[model samples]
Target: MSDLNTSRRTIVKGAAWAVPAISVAAAAPSLAASPEPTPDIDLSTSTPGAAGVVRQTDTQMNISATTFRNTGTVPAEGLVVTFAVDSGQTIEGIQVFGSDIKNVAQGATTSGYGTNTVTLTLAPGTGLGQVTIAPGSEYTSPVGQDILLGQAGAFNLTVTVQASNATANSVGYMPAPQAIPA
Candidate 1:
């Protein structure tokens, strides 16, 4: 009986000492990455077709009239704008336009599209090469550029704009809400 008591005391003492030793040992560190900073994207609603940007649609095609600007230090890159039209609707073509509004005209309000713009062409599969917007640069509302929605009932499209750089990446939907309407 005395031997059993002695054994338990020895075991407890050994464990208590081992815990402190293990805890004091050095550990590499935690593996969590810091979040990257990003610029803000603002969107507006453009009625169907405007400025030859989008084609006419059967159902009231509610397009985006919003424009985006890089109010941050970093530029937004690798931007791919995506969306889907209903069965009756058709995506005739896609277009991306950019401009230096402040440079094109003077006294232009803080809102509205920019001039000195160029229609960015898309690359097959990858769509267009990365759309890079430097700080102070901006793009049109990116509305359903040249989209033709034939029939209108409840139309939903997953419009995503993915912006990425060598250091960071971000994804977001267009200003307009999405609904996969049939």
Candidate 2:
């Protein structure tokens, strides 16, 4: 009778331990395989477009202007402009479009007479090339013009503008916040 009682107690203890162990093991899989979510970032800014130059008259001295804004949380630097210029006309250099309320009719930065002008000479021939993107560096902004040797009809010019530390989007060499001739 004593041996039988001891055997019964052993069976009950074994069952109690086994039940909890099995339950814990079974529950662990659900916790390990659960899915979690990820996070994202936000950026918003504006870029300048290509400057437009049209023959207001039939002289080599045509009118050109480009307007650019930061439209971001910070300031931009080394803005360059690139465009096609006719070799027939003499490119006198770059001048600022001066007029308060809406400046930059001449060029970029520091308004007033003789204050905002850049002298860029053009080469001779039909395809006179110049970079608003400065020499040695890869990008440019703050527009300027190439002095031409002669005149040619509406040449196709491509301008590239960019900024760093804020936002930049480029389709090939051209970056975002762009303007083009109408």
Candidate 3:
């Protein structure tokens, strides 16, 4: 009887250890699987304003171009680029030029004059069909497309680019410590 009891205890202990080992082995395949590649997008913008200043009367700043480059191993799909401005400032107009872009949407504030953010999205398609930017390729906005600003104060301008398959990247332009004066 004592021998039988000892055999049962040994089996129970061995089973307990085997369960954890089996679980670890089961997880090995998933751990060995490769993760999805992330797309690396770079954003570059031409200088804004003259001497980093925009007159309140003019209320306009012409940015030569805003460029997006894909430096990753994967393609950037369903790309959406958003332009935002600081408080006391408004985004008047932003012309986005891209072959894959479907449309541009601008959001209005309570004042109902100009917007604070402009979003650009890609057309409906897949892979190469709706190519936002392929690896090592780049897209640039058209020249003479003025980025209009409003109000009489200093503000910061930020541009964020996001893709369906990759993380987003942002770049900001604040002319001076006080930012671009309007």
Best by TM-score: 3
lDDT by candidate, in order shown: 0.42, 0.34, 0.52
User: Which candidate number has the best lDDT?
Assistant: 3
Per-residue C-alpha lDDT of model 1 across residues 41-139, encoded as one tens digit per residue: 322221222332222444333454545555555655534445554434544333323333223222221221121112222221222332456666665
Give the per-residue Cα lDDT of candidate 2 at 63: 31
Candidate 3 structure lDDT: 0.52
On a 0 to 100 scale, what is the lDDT of residue 125 in model 1? 22
Ranking by TM-score: 3, 1, 2
Q: How do the residues 1-182 of candidate 2 rate in per-residue lDDT, one tens digit apiece?
A: 67646686798999999999999999998779655321111112223333444444343323333333433333333333333332232333343332221133233332221212222222211221222221122322233432222343443334343432223332113433222222
Model 2 stretches astray by more than 4 angstroms: 1-51, 56-64, 85-92, 95-149, 163-182
TM-score each candidate. Answer: 0.42, 0.30, 0.49
* CA error at residue 65 for candidate 3, angstroms: 2.3
Candidate 3 C-alpha error for residue 20, in Å: 4.3
